[model samples]
Structure formats: C-alpha cells, structure tokens
Target: MYSTDRRERTQIQQLTSFVKAWSQIDPATAPFLGTWTAWEETKSIYPSSVKGRVCIIDGFIPNENNIGFRFGQGTVSNGRIKTDSYILIHQGNYLGGVFVYNNEPGIYEYAWPKPLKNPAELMRRVPQSDRHRNHILEQFQNAGCTASRPNRR
Candidate 1:
C-alpha cells in the first residue's frame, strides 16, 4: 500500500505530464478523469461538491461556479502549475490529490467515471475517510465531461 503522500505525489506528476502533453491527450484514454468534489463548508466526506464541480482535462478545468474565468487553465512550467483548483503556489512539487480554492477543498477520489482497474487494491491504500464513494457520480452522469471531465463514459 502506497502512503497518501506517495500516491498524491505520483498523481501530481501524472497531472503535470497531462498538462505538458495537453494537445495529445485523447479523452477516450485519459486516466485521471473524474468529478473532483469541492467542499464549500468543510472537506467533510459526506455530501460532496459544495462549492462546484471541476474536471481536469489536459490543461483546463471547466468552471461551474462562474468564477470569472471561463475555464481554469492548468499551465505547467518549472514544475509549478498555477491553478485555482490545484494548489501549491510556493512549492513547485506535489500538487496534491485534494484541490483547494477560495478556502474550499476538493477531494480527487470522490468521483470515478468508470470503475478503476484495481479499485480494490488502489483504494485499499487510501484512508477510510478518503476512499471514493461515487459522491459526484450523478453530476458526471447528468452533464458528461464537458471539458471538465477526462472522458465521456
């Protein structure tokens, strides 16, 4: 079982690679696509997506809350990705599985469009509270990716 830090570190690296190869990302084969849940009140794992839903494609996060920007851009250079969803402004390394914006936090594991290849094994390493519960499943099912998700299921 990989530690939370390790898993998130790897996930961030994948996100970085995704941004670097944005133009080549085939939505049909993208791996990190899912509904990243935002918490308005607290990052409590019960009711998901309080603030809004954002999907990280190769380089954009389709904004649902009308946060001024039409689409939150994820541009990576010098190891730092400046994004409203993905944090770590000072530290260029480790973007985290959870995203924070305007005080609200988002958990990456909340939504999975398709069942993971090794969901059991992968989820086993995660903390009980952090395991995915299909929290934002309904949203993806309703709206589809819309540039905010990885692929259309």
Candidate 2:
C-alpha cells in the first residue's frame, strides 16, 4: 500500500527500522519484546507523555497503535537490555535507556528517555503485551526474530 502522506511514510520507515533492530536481540531478552501499555499510575510521570498509551514494540507497525518516532536499538545483555533510542528529532542530545527484566514480578521496567526520581520508572506490560510477547515467542524462528529465547522467565 502507498503512503498517502509524509507522516505515514515516516511511520512505515520507523517500523521497518524497528523490525531490523528487534530481530537481532539475543535470545535471553527476547521475552521482553512485545506490545505494552503504560500502567495508569505511570502516565503522569512518564516523560514521553505516554499516559494512556498502548506501546507496540513488536517490530511491526500496528494497524491501530502508534509508537511515535522513537524506536529501540540495542544488544541483549545480562538481566538488562541496554537500548539506544533511535531518535529522529534531536539526534545526539539524549541518552539511551535500559530495559530491566524483572522475572519474579514478571515485568519489564524501562529506565530513561530521561531519568526521573525512580530510575526505572516506565511501563508495565498489559494483557496486549502478554499476548503479543507470547506470540513472538511461539513463532520466533519463523517470524525472523533471530534470538532463540532460552526460558528467561
């Protein structure tokens, strides 16, 4: 399908870039990849103004959601995924954030995009994220999500 305007084009490009980066995540961090919605409590505190937002980092452009211009690019590391924000506006001005996987609580806390009082104060995966993450795990190999998840939960 053809993009009818510049915004749509940019969105498509962002999704394309997102897919490329996400597919390479090392298996250990693969479980964190999915759609996420900010918990009600985090909305006001989130610097990105992500309150009431459903974030889909599933590497594919969603037909109904928008993740804006920011996308993730990072390597899978021990207990955390260090991600650099692929920002288009102020290129090198901001620091990248880290996503820490809390296995016991079954949550992923993202720190930064600007560090607040609580360093890891960002996002709690909702049902959509759970479903999407599980789907990715199930079809990881076929979906080209390169990383082979090794029971990191």
Candidate 3:
C-alpha cells in the first residue's frame, strides 16, 4: 500500500511532467493551462476489481462546484486504466459518465475548456455555501485569476 504522501507526490510529479510535455507542443496542438481548479478527493486504495495496485486522483476543473473531471492514473485491473467515463456530476443528481480517452499509455492531457461568457452563470446555478464560495474564490486567485463580486447574479 502506498502512503498518502507518496501517492500525492506521485500525482504531483505526473501533473508536472504532463504540463512540461504539453508546453513543448505547439499552442494549437496543446491546450492552455489557464485559470482552473483542482483537489485531492480520493484516497489510495487497493481494489479487488483491479488485479494490481491502483490509486484514484479525482477532481473537477474551473472549480469543484462547476463540473466533474475524474482522472485516474495507476497500474490496476490487469495493468489497465480502469474507469468508465468522466462523470459530469453537474446537471443531474447522477450525471452519466462521458467516455473520455481511456487508459492511454501516454501522459494524460486534461485541460480546461475556455471560460464561459459569464462566470457567475455557473455560480448562480450551483448551490454553494459561503465557505465553499470562498474556497473556490481562493482557487481562482491561486490560478492568477481575479475573482470579482457576483454583481451579475
């Protein structure tokens, strides 16, 4: 079993490596690493479904409240990347997963889509507490995006 620190370190390394490789590619081919959000949501666990060891790195982009982008990277399920799809857990209580590129051997390039015309549109639709709101704002700030008051809402 991998320790939490080890798992986190591995994830960070993978993310760093992915970003580096992505940067090397032309802007037209590669996606921009714009103002986005991330979180360490899953814990390291061994699963019977998977033949070997595995770890889940689950989180959403733009922010936690906006959309769900479940990304997993580990040697599991007979050394396969086991996951159905990127669950869009925004619209419905249980939005069906969309089959994103599955278990590709190379590094995963998960990039955020372009910003919406009205950022507050997402915030207004989702039900968020004050703490969640502030946390999301902090994430935006960390990504170098200024968070303005939701005057449009």
Candidate 4:
C-alpha cells in the first residue's frame, strides 16, 4: 500500500509538471490554468453528469455554460504516449481516471481550431472575466503560431 501511495503521489507531480510545460508552450491552454468557473447560471439547462469534474485536457471540460473550444481525445489516457498518459481509477470505470504526464506532445494536439471568429467578435462576446483569455489567444494567433505548437525536435 505504501508503494502504491508513493507512486500515486509521484505521478501527480509528474502530471502537474507536464501540464505546466504544455501550458507555457501552448497559448490557448495558458489562460485556463487559473480560471475555470462553474457557470452555475446554466446548470438548469444541462447539469454536469459528474459534479466537480476537473481534469486537464487541451482545454477545460465544457459544461453547458462552459461551451468553448476543447481539443484532444476526451480522455488523455487513451493515447499511446509513454511519458504522458491517463491513469485509470479502476477496471470498467475509465471516466474517473486522471491524466498523468511526464514529457512532450501531450495526448492532445496542441494546435486547435480557432474558437473565436475574429478578435473584434471576441471582444464583443467575451465576458469581463475572460477578456485576458481572448487577448492572449489573439496574440498567439497574430504571431503565426495559430496553434502554438512547440518547435519540432
């Protein structure tokens, strides 16, 4: 049990490092690191099947009110990457697993389709809380990364 617990802790640390690295390298993912609202106002329309569901994907998991650009396979563990992968909770219940990471090119494609049509449109539609989000995204878009992929090794 002690060994299992130690492995779990180490895995969490590894995954956090991967997320931090990926966030810095990918502009679209950077803003979401700190801000993800529950969007309680839209809960009545469609509730999250799992309460308090927080997992790192290319983007935040979109609840009804949280509709936005989301990339990557729904489950990171589904990928074949050895350094960064998903960790299953148990047999037959993969949804609850947390993704673990240790290296480059996370399970999701770092480059995602533009979520907003244009900067002007984004400025009009973005909520005050998310203004910075659009700005950073636009900067990266204008810089020609468009997808913010790390330089090929």
Candidate 5:
C-alpha cells in the first residue's frame, strides 16, 4: 500500500514538473495562459492566475472519478480558491484526491473512477445493496459527475 505522505510528495513533484514545463513556453507563443502566470510561491502545487483564471495542471489518476465542482463566489480567499469550488477525487469508497476549482461560470464537476486491476472482476464485486449504490452515485453526482463507466481491464 502507498503511504499518504508518499502520494502527496509524488503529487507535488508532478505539479512542480508541470510548472517547469510551462515556464519554457514563450508568452508570445501561448498568450492564453499569460506570461506572468506561474505557480504560487507559498503553494507551489497550485497554478497562479495568469489572466484571472487558475489553471489545473496536475495529471489525474485513471479510473478514479476525479470531478471538479463549483460552489460560487466568496469561495476563494487569501489568494487561494475555496475547496468547494473544486471537485474531490474519489478512490474507491473514499475521498482521495482534489484539484482547484476554476472561476468559470456555472458549477462544473468531473468524475473519474480509480484504476482497477481487473475491471470485469471489480464490476462483478460491486455491492448489490441499493444504499451502497445510491451512496456511490450521490458522491460522484455531488462532485459534478455522474459516474465514469470506463471500458478497461
């Protein structure tokens, strides 16, 4: 099993690498993201607003429903966006990951399921209880997702 600390470190490393890559892009070539934009000094993991929008550059885990949801204005503060503005990445029956919520109009959510060793076998093991199913469905929906039924094994 992977330790949470290890996972967090890996995530941070990945984000740092992404920021480095973005730094190489000339502002003249990609004006959409802006030339002044860069990762925040305090939170090197977060992408700073280049043109009034926070860009999410982290790579998402496959299969896990990683949804991004908006909770409206006043959600952001102290140069940091509100947690509700972002979607919580779900790992199995628990919350495992997250990404910044954009400032775009209307609440947007995304859902992705965790990668499975054997998709068919995992599907077969899905609980038959309506309550369980409903709970899972609700989690994904609340995060602005409707479940991700990916075809993979």
Candidate 6:
C-alpha cells in the first residue's frame, strides 16, 4: 500500500516467516527444546512486504511458554533468508550460561550455524535457571507476538 519497499513490510514479513519456520520443527529434536524455539505471530499494523521469506539460523530458543534469549533479527529478501547476528543464544544452561552459536553462511550455502560456545556464561548468574530463560521469553511476548503452533513441550 505504501511503497513497494518499506520498514513495516520488513518487520511483518520477517515475523510471519519466522513463525512459520518455527512451527515446522524437527521431530527428533522436538522433545528437548531447551531454548531454541521460535513460536510467534506477526501482524501488519502499517503494511509491509510478505512476499519474501525469513530464515533463522540461530539465536534465541523459544518454547511453548519460554521465549528464551535472542540478540538479533534475520534478513528477508527475494524469498531467501539470512541472519544478522554473528552469535546467537540458542538455549540456556543450568548455570545461567546461554548456549551461544554462530550461523555464518558462506556464499549463500545451506551452511548451518555452529556452536561457537555452548553454555556461554551469562553476565548475571540466575539463582533459578528457568527464570533466566523466562525473562527472554517475556520480552517477545510484550512485542505483541502472533500465535503459532507449539513446537515443543
């Protein structure tokens, strides 16, 4: 409605695509979702492009009730996707340390992100480990997250 290219479109397309991808989970890894879940919903309050796709390599792990920690967003263009963060927090550890990873795709290859440092120590230790991860989840919820199918238990 506005211009062909705008900021709102990017946000909508990115969020929608993210929710879709997150809904389609790996059956094998579904049971042990610690933090790497991306359950979300997206809306176009202003109008944005929904043609392209959004791909999340690694970052935050969201669960049915936990949003987990995330640092950045991914790039959505021409139905292709890429990440914007060098390191992403996939999940959290009991020690309040997050499992950090890097999804450095080279030359548009289907290269998955590797664990740069799993259980990366957090700046503030969490007396209750679940609380640390829950904090992140709440942030996304406050962002007016859209509803998606639960990926994990």
- Model 6 lDDT tens row, 1-153: 111222355544544454445435422221112222122311111111222222221333446653344432333332222344322222211101122346534221111111111222321233345665454445334432322433455
In terms of lDDT, the poorest run of 10 residues in model 6 is: 41-50
Candidate 3 deviant stretches above 4 angstroms: 1-118, 146-153
TM-scores, one per candidate: 0.24, 0.24, 0.24, 0.21, 0.20, 0.27
Best by TM-score: 6
Give Cα-based local distance difference scores for all models.
Answer: 0.30, 0.28, 0.31, 0.29, 0.27, 0.29
Per-residue CA lDDT of model 1 for 1-153, tens digit only, reads 122332355555555454334324442223333222222210111111211222332212224432211223233334333356553222222123447658888643222122122222222333333313133333333433333313323
Residue 65 of model 6, lDDT score: 51
- For model 2 the TM-score comes to 0.24
Candidate 4, residues 49-152, lDDT tens digits: the string is 12222222223434556434322221212221111344322221011224445653332212111122223343344464365556544544443422222344
What is the Cα-based lDDT of residue 101 in candidate 3? 61
Candidate 3 lDDT = 0.31
At residue 78, candidate 6 shows an lDDT of 28
TM-score of 5: 0.20
lDDT of 5 by residue, 70-134 (tens): 11211223333334434322223222223433644342222221221111222234444445434
Off by over 4 Å in 1: 1-15, 23-53, 56-91, 94-135, 146-153
How well does model 1 score by local distance difference test?
A: 0.30
Determine which window of 10 residues in candidate 3 has minimal summed lDDT. 87-96
Q: What is the C-alpha local distance difference test score of candidate 5?
A: 0.27
lDDT of 4 at 38: 28
What residue pairs are clashing in model 2? none
